[model samples]
Target: MDDIMRAIFACIPGMRSPASPGGCLSAAFGGGDDDGEEGEGEGEDRISRLPDAVLSSIVSRLPVKDGARTAVLSPRWRRVWASTPLVLDDADLLPDDDGPQIFWRDVADAVSRVLAAHPGPFRCVRLTNACSYAGSRGAAALSRWLGVLAAKGVQELVLVFLHAWPVRVEPPADVLRVSSLRRLYLGLWRSFPDTEHLRPGADVFPNLVELGICRTDIKAKDLDRLLQCSPALETLAFVVSYNTQPNVRVRSRSLRCVLFWMSIAEELAVVVAPRLERLILWNGCPCTRRVRRDFRTRVKIGYTPELKVLGYLEPRIHVLEIANTVIEAGTKPSPGTMVPTVKVLAMKVRFGVRQEAKMLLSFLRCFPNVETLHIMSAEADEPTGKLNFKLKFWQDVAPVECLKAHIKKVVFKNFRGERSELAFLRFVLERAQILQTLVVVLTDGDGDHASQEELGNRLKPLIYSTHRASKCAEFFIFVRCGGTSWSFRTASDLSRSDPFDC
Candidate 1:
């Protein structure tokens, strides 16, 4: 039976019998000699038969050390590994038991050897964990390695410092001149020097598209100069960094996305971005406990006519001011003035602060064309504060065109059944004439099945009784489970006898 199976397998297309010389199946089935021999009994190397591109792809996916080790496999693989793009990561080079000094030496040596041997076009070179340990000597070695990468035409470069100590390595000036560099990420570095020292008429990072600097001290003016240098830059991000300037101005015509998270800039101004699409600003500082409010950071958006999504603006933001008054008031724009043209807007609303709630109306007026509105409800931290989200306040404000015509969906996260919270939803239901869906995400306080049911019962009557302009508008109630996943149920699906059962 076994003989018959083998014969059948051999008869199949691209399959060979064990006795056939240099056959893939014979070698795979251990029918060939184990020793490295050039004899008649040897079967074909099936893996080596793969095309160079496919083999290169396989090596590229491996850790840099393992990828380079393919040289021992065979002559064909050796050539493929050498030509494949380098992805050197220091973490992969050193074992967990290795000390910092050993890690530094090994990583530096491996990177130098690979860069020296590889002939052309490195895809990416990532040197992490060794940056903090890479003192002046290591920095010099790194600088030389970078020069080699520049000659080889590297596309992506990432340097990460994992240790708490800052990396003292001042990146070589060649970093700015790397014509082939498209994406660059630098983290936990002491500082980046100002670009003012560049020779006159010199354009830095001409081809850079995405730049991210995290946990690094970079002066606002220097950062601005860097952006000015990269004419083709599209996405820029700064996270957990200290800025020397109080106000950072980003003026770029080609930029599309800007993300600032937990950054300590007093203010950020998007002076010009004609093609901008997304803007995200988040400050993770705990200002809830502070009595004085001096650390407030304001973001000013200017001349982004194509802007589509703007969000995660926390309560910490003093204001998201649009420099173009025409955009803010939704009036006809002067020839050169820019308007928001935003479709999706996400913001935090403090429930008990009447002034804050009124500010929401002002925001709604600014983005007159917004179709989706996401509101994160914030409760008063003090016990004596009264809930300020009164429906009357919204009634008194000028009607926002989007609420009546454009807004189709509204999401209220952290829904605690405070009077103000219900009032906010009630106002939306009454005003959003074309609304299609309303999603209410209950807080952890209502995590239990009974509490969820009770909250649902309370909201159902209030939503149903509210004068909704769109008869087709649907309501969805989401309850948190064990502070993790959310379970949702549609209002229409709930039974009349047991509305809370849903």
Candidate 2:
């Protein structure tokens, strides 16, 4: 409800101010008789002096039911809500009280009623009632509702299946006719439909700027076609549960950010996304099981000259390819291997794994302009052979350009008091010349919390944790998964500049 708004009238600046007696109301919904009308006028006034644009903004910011209820406030308010683009989420129509829970049919009926009541031009519509579609009408097709949405000129939409579990059904051929969509999220799908066989230039998402697909089994050819059709799509994201095709190649003209969660791409080549800024891969596994699973992915950089923030890359499994050359542990830093545009980088390393530990240097060498670095301390269960990048290994290795000059902040996550872990931290403490802050997030999920100073004093015995290299550098520690866990929203959010932290 909070983040669903797309701000249709953002240019209406200089029109908003504090509300008067009639401008702001918490519970008044135009209920008054003789005495109540007098009280409502003075206490819950409906004579808002705000401009039409500002009134729309205020109404859009409120909850769906409350925003609609503003119509009962005054004649002017009714006109404003009727003229403004509607932002409807079905959850609001469902009652929150414990008195006689409404059936799925009731909720669906209420949603239909609301949509019918509103005028044309829907800013956004989130339909979660689809998850209960089967329970309500027994495999009823959701295309009917989609048609209604299209006719209403919805600019943003969140569409989910009406069934409890996912089923791959060919949606109506005219589904893409919803050309007014600016942002679309297709949820609970086995895979996105391939429209390659459609008639030449049948229909494309001309206005679609942001797209999200969740619970999908993504295929390369289909994914490529989806991007091609949406020529104006700038942000493309996916949250796949079981990825069948591990090889994906992206070629988009308008894409700026691409994020993946709980997905696997054995070989992903960025064929061409000139304006691409952020490429993120997060969450190793799909379902949370007690046992381990393989989640290896390799990335090939082709023509993404604008990529800035990248990672959660596991060197133990991932292969980094720049243009044509595959970056290896012994590969010397050169223009071919470097990406000077990257300002923030994240990595996943099991310091215990000899092969994985050595590849970190080669990966770090690729991003020379990285200012903030995040490292996820992967759990090493198998007790791999002797660690390769210990204190001695780090001391003798060639200097990492970013560590010596550009790196200002470093965050070590899921820290456990292991010998190999301390050795890596010690090396960074001594080598990083201008390090600003070292934030360590402990994996003490056992429900115990410790302060930063206390943890630093405790670590002094195991590792002289030199008080950071730079005079301005400081150390911080926190417990309870302080913004460490991953989610589809976190992976794709543009508001949060650094998803590595919050």
Candidate 3:
């Protein structure tokens, strides 16, 4: 071990002399045996024998303070912490009991010290719960920190302030110009820095691929400028952004995936982006129920020929207007109008028992080619007696092509065996000719063993009596127990788990 340590230390870039006390190899495994010469010991320093790259990786994964402590282990490792790309989070160093002011000061000082001590490139720097008490100084400190990181060619940067009051940090100009950055996530900022001086055709964030801005006060024009500057941007997410414009237009050909969550906009116009494949929108806001009023916000998907997955869509916002034509419930699309090329559709249903089946059927009719369907209950379960699902509900409705030819999987969460729920299940089972798997997850109230057994017995006759279109289709039921729920993956989901007995 001593000989191996000596050999490893000799290869390090700026290692101290072997006899020095600061030498990590000597400190880790004693200086030498009684022989007084360097290499004579049976002691094992197994970790030191690994390659330097591996050791650096292991140290990088540790908390910043823990990683910095490696400096005291041995001289060979003294520079390891300083050279490896840093991943710093302010919350890790802040004490829970410290006053907000003191917390801000401590975090600022710690970040400054780490950045000044570490040399060269940085992989990531995440600062969470920051700037709550630093006021103007906090903003300046953050700007300076970001400037230093930008100079160091950092790759990924995340700055999150979860305070109720508006964040005062002014985004550093260096952030907009960093060429090495590939991903950037900034949350809870009051606003974005102005980029009016940037040239029209010049590239900003030349290598940036993914960008997420949550709960920020960025304006519509400023966002458009940012998107225009990033030619390589592919995936973009705007969650709870305060864009007060009547329409937020995102036009990008390189983008493939877009996620809009809890944002306040009257309309989302996807004007260009021929390569877009996935579009996800969730209007549910955690802060207040008033934000639910934004559910009326409409979406305009245009020229996205490659769109394959459209999901988490609220029923109120299901009316999508493609190229000036509306696709809404009770209205069939005109000929030559491009339907969404979506294959997987996930949506929430909250209509009353009398309208549940009707609303679901209307929504499904919009996506004729969707093969996998995921349904989540948008409201509390309805009483069994209130549900009214009759065979006449499907009598007047025309057949949906996907149900007979393409739909192979269905997942229903928050299931209660109400009359309408059972009727809907039976209707799908009897109609979906190519169905392969059906997953029904019962609600927490119905999780008891007795309730589960009774529900299963009630559903058994329906399953046996119905003439299923797919002879090989199987049904699965998942029940919650002690707060956690068990899951069974089907063959279609690439699993070989045994089928549930229920």
Candidate 4:
């Protein structure tokens, strides 16, 4: 158990020191015998020696089970959990055979006890448990706990109880109305008939800056009302849960950094924030066999002039990350619409046929100023076809004349020695007027491994082939992924210009 724990602890990113002995034993091995006085002393020794602030930080990130066990470590540790702020992360919460009523009852009881034991104002409170409990009793218990924390003047409150209780229980509006609440992350817990009943504009979170919600089923009117209430909100992130047929138009005046992640089913209608500097959207079809069934399907998308204001980086925005999506052929934006000012574009195209090449070429037309481009194969049953997609993609997208002027270098990692692949290198060599350097990264997956002798013999003819060969500054084919251990035979001297027998 200790060895297993040490292995796991070694994998902890950026953690230089060893894991706390108490935490390791408690989590990996069963809770060590604490029935006697000697056990109590051992627990106390682990708690008292460790830094309190470190312990607090560690406990906050851990699951409730692990965090609760720390309290049994020693007398000092017993009350530390209540004193330290709690960030209830429900990402790891999985359903069990135990009914919802019993589950939430236990959770609510534990939370209530902790809060009551330490009545001090907490730094933050995040409750994101989405379990279908039996009755409205569990919801009531949650509200009561939240009410207590609200009364205590908590700084950051994040209530995310999506699909937990069936009743349309309203959130503790009295707590949300508090001016002290700076960061609020409230997601949908229960269904609401109207925005007014939930008291949207009636309350104000004056100091609120950052708010995030996922799977929230707020209507257009309700969304507007909620936005109006938070006049000072700066960073707003929404991961749409439900697919509204017509799609809702989102407008935020004070929002600067907006992150919208929704399915392609919804219209991408969002009024461009004038003061917005960064807008990120994750909208693309899933990378699976399902896409093949949905191909050539024209989905309705909405846009407005407000989005066009930032002619450089709004509307569709920049820094795109689309995976396993086949963009319909013949779909082009308006004529005057110059591509947004894109700096870096990372795309994982799923389509295999010539259409994929055409789409790559099409997408590149929009990002004329793109400096770096990264493309990878998607996780599908079929392989990225035997064609020279990358070469074709680059040839069609990167105009020879323009590339020579702007593009500084070209790098092909998985370079197979196909005629098309060779033609790609030849094209770049012939076209790129200002091309300074060309890097070819080879892979052994292509075919049988050729020895260094065979490669040198093949290139021996190139020395006296033509003057174009001399212009090549660095024309060495990297072998076996090319690292420190890579052995390069000095086949012909670097200065040797003759192609004949050396």
Candidate models: Cα lDDT each: 0.64, 0.69, 0.64, 0.45
- lDDT tens digits, residues 1-502, model 3? 2332232222212211123222232323555333222344645656666677877876776666767887766666676667777776665567646565554666767778888888868887766645344434445676677778888988887765544445346566666877888888776556776778776556888889878776666667777888888888887877665444567788886887777755557788888888777777765444335455435667787878888777666655455676787655565644434454888787777644445445566667767788888776656355323443546665456787778788888877666666666777777887888888887766567457887666667677776787788866355433332222322111011121211112
lDDT of 2 by residue, 384-403 (tens): 87655554776687889999
The C-alpha stretches of model 4 lying farther than 4 A from their native spots are 1-83, 87-103, 124-139, 153-194, 197-203, 207-210, 231-235, 240-242, 260-262, 275-292, 295-335, 378-502
Off by over 4 Å in 1: 1-49, 96-103, 135-138, 166-169, 199-202, 285-292, 324-340, 383-385, 388-391, 394-397, 444-458, 472-502
Error of 2 at 343 (Å): 1.8
TM-score of every model versus the real structure: 0.78, 0.80, 0.81, 0.56
* Candidate 1 residue lDDT tens string, 87-146: 666656676464554645666676677778878778877766454455445557666777
Ranking of predictions according to lDDT: 2, 3, 1, 4
Error of 4 at 56 (Å): 4.8
lDDT of 4: 0.45
Residue 380 lDDT, candidate 1, scale 0-100: 66
**Residue 232, model 3: Cα distance from true site in angstroms:** 1.9
Collision count of model 3:
3
- Model 4 scores worst on lDDT over the 10 consecutive residues at 485-494
What's the CA RMSD of model 3 in angstroms?
10.0
Q: Once superposed on the true structure, which residue ranges of model 3 sit more than 4 Å away at CA?
A: 1-43, 95-101, 129-135, 164-169, 242-246, 292-295, 335-340, 351-357, 380-388, 471-502
Q: What is the lDDT, from 0 to 100, of the residue 397 in candidate 2?
A: 74
Clash number for candidate 2: 2
